[model samples]
Target: MTTTLAAGPAPVVARPGPDIASRRRRARTRERTAQWLFLVPAIAYVLVFFGYPIVKNFVMGSQDYTVRTFVSGEAPWVGLDNYVEVVTSSIFRTSVVNTALFTVGSIVGQFVIGLLFALFFKRRFPLGNVLRSLLLLPWLLPMIAGTAVWKWILDQDGGVLNEALRAVGLVDAPVHWLTSPDVALVAVVIVNVWVGIPFNMTLLYSGLQNIPEELYEAGALDGATGVKAFWHITWPNLRPVVSVVLVLGVIYTLKVLDIILGLTGGGPAGATETLATDSYRRSFQEFSFGTGAAVSNILIVVSLLFAVVYLRANRRAVDE
Candidate 1:
């Protein structure tokens, strides 16, 4: 056996260049970095403002917290007493009902009126743009100021409403519109409708405008006219918009605070009270943070429920 074979050539070393796995890992890191870079500002804002407040509010709500004692950092633990009080209290339940009332009334009234406007303004007419612009006045005005204007307009003695009523001999005496729960609730609903109409009108009008004119013409040729044509052509096409506006109207009007606050402050018997107003008073005025949080959570639940319903409706519409 001969001899020592020449030593095998020194083992060759592989280059350190990236293999498939390493390359994939590097790419993933780059993508992750890009995602975080894009999200940093939003994350920071939420953490600093919304997130911190929400968490702190939750923590403080569990304690017997108040401004004076909070600074000393010895806030007493109150357990679920706050929650007990909130649910058991008569005020929260009344507010829930009032909110529901306001939302339902406003949405129905606004839809009827907004559909009218959408139909009216659908076609090009003289000064149509001007009319639409003027229609936006209620929506463009600041919420508090706008509601305040309505408040004054509904004032029992000096309101323009009463004045107009008397001028037209519609009433025998001035009505205490805001001082009575029954009337005040109705008045607030009216104000909400006024504010919401322009929004729904504009949105529905845009949706209506998107429909192909040929569809209407075809329906007309088939002897469908007026209400029949609208039922067959317009309503079907505008269904999505209608659903969206109705759902959005429900959500927005449900959380409505300025309108109720400016008009009624939930006065006369909590008849005009809503979850939003109740939450505000509980947290700010009554120093019942837990109760306020509970109300807010309920409000959020209601909104989310409606949102889910709307989305289901939209999906069904799409599937059809």
Candidate 2:
């Protein structure tokens, strides 16, 4: 005990070796440099394309920029005139209603069809792979080609749909699917649903795949089976994926341009003119860029609202 003298204050620990610290600093610098090198192309692309266009659109919308009101020099600002005109105008009002109908209809139809196909594919039956690929064929086709094919099927006089109806004696006359204002919207929605179904199926199928079989086994132990298991486990698991798919579908359906332009050109007295088509018609067709841009901005606002809601839902899902 007497020999165990108290130790003196501990020697000041040497700082890290200079070479080791230097090597770490160099390694960190290299890593940072590599990260920036990888990000350079992406940063450049965003600034050039997305950033520039967004800024330009806002700037262009601000000025009296229509072909009618345009001048080479700085444009005179017309405060709220474009907004007022678009809101008050009759065609614009009609366009708003049609857009609403088309959006809701497409979402409903696409959702139903997509859900069915997704469920069908989840079972992994024989030929499921072949069927899955074939199902995606419509989605893969060029927009122009897909529209052309639908045009053939929907041709009032000589279309295959009419021929089949006649052969089956389902109706007396070949239904003028596209020409009639009443049915034209529905027809376009049908095409959209059919085309969009594959995407929904694919996304949902993947989500379904991620559901652990252990959950189902656990449920079975509790006497849960079939639809009950699906509701309790499968649905909870897929809800996150479903939210994303539907929100994206809403956005995609809202911007449905080529299909409407290709099929009907918003014809039969503007029955099929969605907000997107209306924007195109006003801007390009009539050279009213300001008004078109306003409509576009409105669409963007709507999309943003949906995005916000979807993001909130996703955050909640992750927390759960």
Candidate 3:
């Protein structure tokens, strides 16, 4: 005879009480609100600092905002007159050209010298770390102090450089570095390059360190050594880092004011007067805040264009 099978008890289904359901919903809402509260300070900071300044600058560019306007609290709308005056001014062309030269010269000199230093330091040597650390001194010094020292070194008469040259019989007369229009731009570029080299070197050295040694070993096995190996391996690997460095260099160079102001004060026929200095001159020196704002807005546009270029470059780099 077959044994009868016993039926098992049904599984119990527990439903939540309305009170429990509401409590869970309330808990989730509270958690989300807490999270948002954590982010509020940062969001508010950006809105207040960056957003407000940029919008105010744009608005100021369109109005005749002078020193008098600050006292009177009346900035009359002038449309594009500020922009028109900025672009049409006699020194506008000179400032534009000088800005281009300064940016290019500073970036090129800094990157090249920095790359060489980075490569040199890649090899293990005595006091290598110490030397690299010391290189940052120029970068760490106050801009005002650095420029002041450079000013003395580059003085038209009684400067160390001219004296050294005379001692070595290199030149018969003192070279007016900051005084002559032809030499002032070069002097400013030199100072800027010196200040920027350490930054480039630090970044490039870090990038070089990130590259795998095994790749270099493998490359060497295929007769890719020294320059060949670097061209095929190091450069390709470093392209992304190089792009970042170059783009940042361009952006920083574009807005350089303190160094130029301290070194030359955009003097000697406005030879070294960049967009930054020109904007300052218009606003503070000439008391034409509208024109200053207009110049600054134009500078921002130029910076944004470069930013677009950086985006494109970064995307291409990622694709590759």
- lDDT of every model, 2 decimals: 0.86, 0.86, 0.94
Query: Each candidate: RMSD to true structure?
Result: 7.6, 2.3, 3.0
- Cα lDDT of model 3 by residue, 156-238, tens digit: 78889889999999999999999899899999999999999999999999999999999999999999999998899999888
Q: Mind giving the per-residue lDDT tens digits that candidate 2 earns over 9-61?
A: 98898889999999999999999999999999999999999988877776666
Error of 1 at 127 (Å): 0.7
Model 1, which residues run further than 4 Å from truth?
A: 1-36, 43-63, 74-80
Give candidate 1's error at residue 53 in angstroms.
4.3
User: What is the descending TM-score order?
Assistant: 2, 3, 1
Backbone clashes under 3 angstroms, per model: 0, 0, 0
Indicate whether candidate 2 or candidate 3 has the larger TM-score.
2
| lDDT measured at residue 245 in model 3 versus the true structure, 0 to 100 | 92
TM-score, structure 1 vs. true: 0.83
Choose the strongest candidate by lDDT.
3
Predicted model with the maximum TM-score: 2
- Candidate 2 differs from the real structure by a C-alpha RMSD in angstroms, to one decimal, of 2.3
TM per prediction: 0.83, 0.91, 0.90
